[model samples]
Target: MGSTEDTTSTTYSDASSSPTQPLLSNPAPTYPYPYPDPPPASEPEPTQFLQISYNYGPRPIKDLPFLLLFSLFALSTFAFGIFSSVNRNPNSSSVSSFSYDSTTASCVKNATTSSTLRSPTFLPLPNSFALHSSSSSLLKSLIWTLVITLIISVPFAFSVLVLLKHYTKQIVYVSLPFFVIVPIFVNVYWFVACTVSSTCDEKFPLAYRILVLVFVFVIIGVIVWIFVVNWHRIELTVRIIGVAADALSRNLGLFGVLPALTLGLFVYFVPIVVFLVLARLNGKIVAREEDGEYYCVWKQDSWVPAYYALAIITMFWSATAMVEAQAYVISGTIARWYFSKDGSSLKRSLRSSLRNAFGPSSGTICLSGLLICVVRFVRAVVDNAREDAPGMVNLILRCCVNALLAAIDFLNKFTINFAAITGEAYCTSAKMTYELLRRNLLSAVFVETVSTRILAGIILVLSAIYAIVVCVILKAASNLGVDSYFIAVMAWVLLIVVLGYFVHVLDNVIDTVYVCYAIDKDKGEVYKQDVHEVYVHLPISRNSRSASALVARTPLVV
Candidate 1:
């Protein structure tokens, strides 16, 4: 039976068939041994495999034209500022008419007599106490203080990195508890002291006491709320930090690159500072009378204010660009390290990342940088308005502007990270990032709140301690008088900048890891198993069945 069936089918298949009909129609029933039917003759099987070629370089230069135009404008404005400064004559009456002799003499007499410069008979002095004392000594003290701060902060930054790497969880736990307890202890101590000391009762009136109590309660509530909400995710945050530290430690070359970028920024600012100082020389000195005294004031040229505005805007843009550039470099480097199969490519990754940051992706950085600068500038404007005119309207405007600034900052964070990884344009990267994060059930706000608060707390504590240490050392070593306060303030600022950069690098690392993890989850692939194992605990949206399933699987550990 099988032989006869096969012979009949073969004979029919061999016969000339109509072009419209397939000869193998219903071929499955032809043999006793069931045979599978062939595919319809109209649809041909694909013979050519789709090839995906990866291009290593020459990425489409995003926002290049805008970048170039802005650069040209910046350079022209800088030149104009320089020319205005150089052409102004210091010996001109307008420039030299304002005499400081009387003020200087009064200050000197007050200093020698050990009396306050604010004697009723004396003209009002500048707000800075340094101005009332020996300005030269104050300047010297500030310079020395900053120098000392830099020396100390470098080592401190390294120590922090080491601590973060080895004892992230311990630090978080200890610091958070201390942070909570210290405030409570201080508030209690204050209340007790106020109750016991009659002087405190007189100094802190009922209204003041009530205000302080309210402020304390509000702050404590906020702290407690943050702590409670993020408690479960603390471990995940630590793991993220640990992974960042590990990646950074492996690619130590980033450390070198960061400082170089900073130095470059400093170098770039030199001319800006010079231009700012010289730009002031562009105005005409006009004679003016105040308090029955005639003094020649330099009235700036009409264009000077506009020029100043331009310079200021340029500075903001440049500063933001430098910061964003650093983020890009860190993100690119860390993302590369995260995806690479081995440590052999560490140096190569850093180099390539650097090239991409400053090369093709630079325009994207500039675009984002400009946006942040504009937002910040507007916020500053609104803040000034609020300060000058404190009203509900100004306050509300300020609040709205602040919220906008924060939103931009939040969006820029991950957008730049995605752009760093894929070399996408700013808008495109932002869209893709939003979709990727949304699809993966990630909350930008939650991650930001948890990670930022923790890191900010660490930096604040370190900076405060550093400031106190510097103050103590200054008090022991020098008789700076009121200048000591100025020095300490400057020292604090320096430490914040130094430590802030350290934190900034780690922050970028965290953002990069977040984006990389999101990519992995979206594609249903694990690029870094250890990270995947830890991140599996990250909270996903309850509605996401696919994400739930993905999380349910046991992470494959190498």
Candidate 2:
């Protein structure tokens, strides 16, 4: 359903150019300083690499503004943590009295009791030590503090090593420091909350809460103001998504869609099933009856570590395989759309694409999965820690793990896209994908941020409606024989899986198409596109080298 009109041949150069000559055989003319000189002909011509890297590195000077901005914000957050801690313990009274008021005590109780699989429920402080602020309890708390601190530090330290080893640019490396400081800030924040409320209820005093509300309102107002101001750009982004959806619909017909959905669901559910098996093996998933209802619960046992270890291993395998397969399918579908090929061409490409993903790209995505495993392992640690005792240490550790998880997830999205496009391994593709985003920061941010939020919201709304309809039908059909809670849980889980499947499909298409667009635009001579105008009209800064580089850079593919 895309434009079949071939405006221009996929020609690389002028009409007078020899048919045998390659498009990028000659070095591009030199630009001003800071842009590196063209590599010698013997060096395999750096233009292609530059075109790939074009999307990544900008001069350090160009990123100075962002670095300074984030640094100041991180420092401010860190300082605020310290300030709150001091206010909570002006004379060190908190150190002597590990006591809580009734309100805080009830809040903790409710939080612990009402927790479910979908959310983290608070647990009261561990009773391993005495309740009094005795020396033994204090010493145990300090040891817990150090252990949690070390656990949190491990992942960040690994990330730092990764950045140093692979990414030399200031913009790439500088972001790590900000991430590292976040856990410290979180730790301090929790320390302050525990010191003040003793039970870690995050409610501030009435006056402070009012001030916080005012600040939040001001932030919301500013966000609204910005959205209103940039309505046109947002509209254009929506239209671009519409174009992508059209392409997706045509390329991934019922036959293609089912396979993609099956692959994604299999990958996702297999781990859960394996985890369950492991749980059962450890005798953790215990069945019990309460109030005439039968239900199952997970009880951690001594073999819990074994369960986690196996879960991590399976997660790496499943994620690697899933990501590789998804990339192949998505990229294959987009290739057909980009090239305006027939259905038969898609069929032809499918086998080859899958081969590429599972064959050559296995090791690369496995590396990516290793990163995912690390994040998951850390999460498992945090979850176990919290289950043992939900205190300031676990709270801070969970927060830090969540932040790192998000960062890794974001990185993986691009890594998959890069792997799809280049058939490179995970790390190489990640570097390349990051480079592209680095080069086209404005457009990348605009498209990804706006589209993800809007598309997810739309999908979730539809999913909710669908879930409600299915639940009503199921309830009515069974004459309400089934437990309503079980029905609701199944419906929700199914909806999420279904919605997530399509969401990821759309995500891959969007990423692939944009990468194609960037590469095609850089190449300058290709079958023209109807959707380039959408990107053209988006708000990229005119004066910045980053924007100009995107504009002036040649396409990566012929």
Candidate 3:
């Protein structure tokens, strides 16, 4: 019994001390009941992702190629257009023999005649004599104005120079307009003097004529080269202007936007209009016949002060209203797009959008717009000052200010988007928008530089086509010869109105999309899930906080 007990104890101790295998891993096959077969390991499902590789941040270096191509295309197109315009049929109805009489403030209607009758040689003596006589007084007014301007500008120029020196900055030599302005002044004086004296009319000096021609050609060449070099930026700017105009028209179609915009414009212009009317009443503004031309002259220089005051008031009132209207329109556009509210009545949506724009959330948008407008206004003032004074130092100073203003303008648009989204103040929305942009710098750059440009270009082309169509229609319908200049003006206005409306729509669409994209990229996957794969692609990861957060929120787009 003692030996059997000792053997049992030894077997128990051995069993307890033996090495054991994990139950979850491979179990012993020889066990009484084998562990259930381990589930077969499977490979991770391939991630369905769109891989986009790009150099993040604003890449002005990458933009060089695009700039060059756009510049070349623009220059070529412009040259072709000019050639076509110059070579058009001389006998076309666009040719007119009407002469503008400044003295009478009337356009003299000449009988229908050949193109030769419209030449300089056929200009009536009464009109020519009137212009010649009036040139003396005009010349005197210009000289006095320049003298006064110079006297006032001297101290300002000195201060600008001092500030520029302290800052240790330099400006491009060409940007200093003194060299150009001086020559232009001298040339203008000489031309006017010669015209009044009638010295170069019948037997003009060939050498002088050739010299003038050479200078003009050189200036033209320089202008052409500059246009070619800066076509990309110029084109972009023009398209943006077009978009704003387009937006104005579209907003008008909606109930509130138009009224708001019109009110803003009215507020801005009413002061100036009233001042002019008062001036006319006070005999400050008068129309006088000089030779055969009509000259409207202000009776007193004192009116200038009042004019400036009215201008300032107008600018302030208009700017505020314009900003308010813009905010309302943009917010309405985004809301409609996001909520899939296309089926809703225009008046209702307009009312809601306008309400939201003027509501508590609109403070930031208004402030941002105000800041941009102020900076831009200052820049414009400085720009005009530079033209008048033409100092390198002042140019340098303005350049620094302009750089800052450009940055403000650049960020202002995005801030508006954020403001539209959350009704946050300008600074708050700007900060958040900036953070998102920093994280997704490459994407923002792509959308801004590439996407915006392409859309703008398409709209610009369409505007041109529309203008051509209008011109053709006008020509076909009209029986009498219409003035080419008049037709051109009409066409230009029409194009601006039409283009402004369409471009505004396009701009809003792009802005809304970009805002949505940026939000999704930073905050998570709401918009991405709803949008088609072509619109957006986000990485699938268990660790993504944004994506997870987004799942709880409804998608902004379908």
Tens digit per residue, CA lDDT, model 2, 1-558: 112212122122232233222222344533222224645545554434444312211111222332344334334433433433333323222222222234432111112333346767777678634444454543553354335434543343334223322342332224323332433443455455555773344544546645654665566556556656866665565666665665565554533544665677566655455444434333223344569654444444554465455444554555554554566567655754575533334554555555554555545545555566567777777777877887888788788878888877777876766665556555556666665565465676677777665556444544444445555665665433334434544555555555565656676677777767666655663543566765666555333344334534444221
Candidates' RMSD to native: 12.9, 22.6, 25.4
- Residues 1-558 of candidate 1 have per-residue lDDT tens digits of 566555554544433221221211211222222345644445433431121111246677887975896697689777887788778756444344244345442111112333457746765667656565667776778887788778988888888888888998887777786666656765876787786789889988868877887799789889898788767888888777777777677767777888998898889878878887777776555556679765655677787788778878787788898888888888888887777775444657778877888888889999989988888878778877866888888788778878889877888888888778888789877776655555443545555567777887888776766676777887888877646766877888888888888887887787787777766654556678987776666675443445335433423221
Candidate 1, which segments miss by more than 4 Å at Cα?
A: 1-55, 90-148, 185-203, 210-214, 283-300, 384-404, 463-494, 542-558
lDDT of 1 at 435: 58
- The lowest-lDDT stretch of 10 consecutive residues in candidate 2 is 53-62
For candidate 1, give the lDDT: 0.71
TM-score of each: 0.71, 0.49, 0.44
Please identify which of the two predictions, 2 or 3, would achieve the higher TM-score against the true structure: 2
Query: On a 0 to 100 scale, what is the lDDT of residue 354 in model 1?
Result: 79
lDDT of 1 at 218: 87
Per-residue lDDT tens digits for candidate 3, residues 388-428, read 87878887888898888877766776667665655545565
lDDT for 292 in candidate 1 is 77
Worst-scoring 10-residue span by lDDT in model 3 = 48-57
Count clashes in each candidate, considering only residues at least 3 apart in sequence or on different chains: 0, 9, 13
Instruction: Name the candidate, 1 or 2, with the larger lDDT value.
Output: 1
Q: Which of the numbered candidates is closest to the native, going by highest lDDT?
A: 1
